[model samples]
Target: MPPLSEILKTTTTPNGTPWLTSARVGDGYLLRYAGMADFILNGAGSQLTCWRVEPGVSADTIRHLVLDQALPMVLNRRGREALHATAIVTPKGACAFSGPAGSGKSTLPASFFLAGFGALGDDCLPLVEQNGSIQVLPGYPGMRLGRDALEALSAASGVTAPVADYTSKRRALALPSAKNFPREPVLLSRIYRVVRPKEGEP
Candidate 1:
């Protein structure tokens, strides 16, 4: 079950995690974080509110709140599960990679793009059940990577594609537009999880 934040208007510190406290205000949720901006996410997640308590906060912060946090909640309300995964379209079909942070979920999709594949989604991948089978939804047409990560991709064909500003940790680039990476949901063909091999392993 989701948190009862909508009912518990006050008593934010029932526990110790301040970030988890959410209150309802006129059919919306307001989440406050110490030393950071308070985010007011609408019940439907169509609106976002942020009030920065300090400087140096970038607009990307709010974007993440909408894309990664609020949007998922909205999807959940519609009976969908948002997974922390990155997916790409290949000659075979759409493939997704999911794992913890620093698990190369983003980098693997970036590599697929450089290798002449199309990216379907990055960071947040949506899954839905249809006819008793699970399928992956088409997502944003960009991959987020660091500036240094662009070196190899830019040199792939000497075209030197430009990377747009995305977030503090990465750059965003438009993925290829073609039938291979169509902007429509496709049947999930495969999923890979990248992990660090223990030392002494081949």
Candidate 2:
């Protein structure tokens, strides 16, 4: 049982939360999120080791945290271009939707899923380049779409999209909580960035 302190330097974040810190640990990165899940992502960004905190936390919450933070960070450091994008697998190939916050990144991919394509993930897509080819490494299979987005999908398809999980103003839009993600990597085809026109212009 090697303690994190022996393997890496420690630091504190002043964000009034228990997300202690993840530092450059020996040949890897260490993470302590919400003072619960203690984990390490190996230098290759291919392996992870995790443990529960004293009182334990929901595995679902830990999974979400790892997707949003640790895994992306590790992959980015390992030379993959981690995009702030959502991705879907179309018949042609994998397509990415990238933009800043509030740019409908999640909604667009969800639309593709409804149109019969498969969702790679709704956020945190990593592009791995090899031998002059780019591949879309899938993220967690889920879409965090707003209420209106879900409603629109339901109405258009005439099927009530199940809410996999609850958030503040959105629901985790996936069958049985998005943990059922596909693993096959798809070749990169196109990436579309969302842009909105001025209110009075269009």
lDDT of each: 0.64, 0.67
Q: For candidate 1, lDDT tens digit of each residue in 1-202?
A: 2243454433334355444345675667766544446666667766666644446655665565556555665666556888888888776767889887666788777877767777777777788777777778887766666555666556333323333122345445444442355666777889898886778988
lDDT of 2 by residue, 1-202 (tens): 2344443444544544344576666766777664566777777888877755546455555666666756777777677788878888766888898887567888777776766677777678888876688988877665776668777767333323333222333435443324445687888899998876668876
- Poorest lDDT segment (10 consecutive residues) of candidate 1: 157-166
lDDT of 1 at 36: 48
TM-score of every candidate: 0.69, 0.67
How much is 78 displaced in model 2, in angstroms? 3.7
Q: How close is each model in CA RMSD to the real structure?
A: 6.0, 5.3
Model 1, TM vs. native: 0.69
The residue pairs found clashing in candidate 1 are: 145-171
Q: Model 2: how far is 74 from its true place, Å?
A: 2.7
lDDT of 2 at 146: 64
Model 1 has an lDDT value of 0.64
Candidate 2 weakest ten by summed lDDT: 157-166
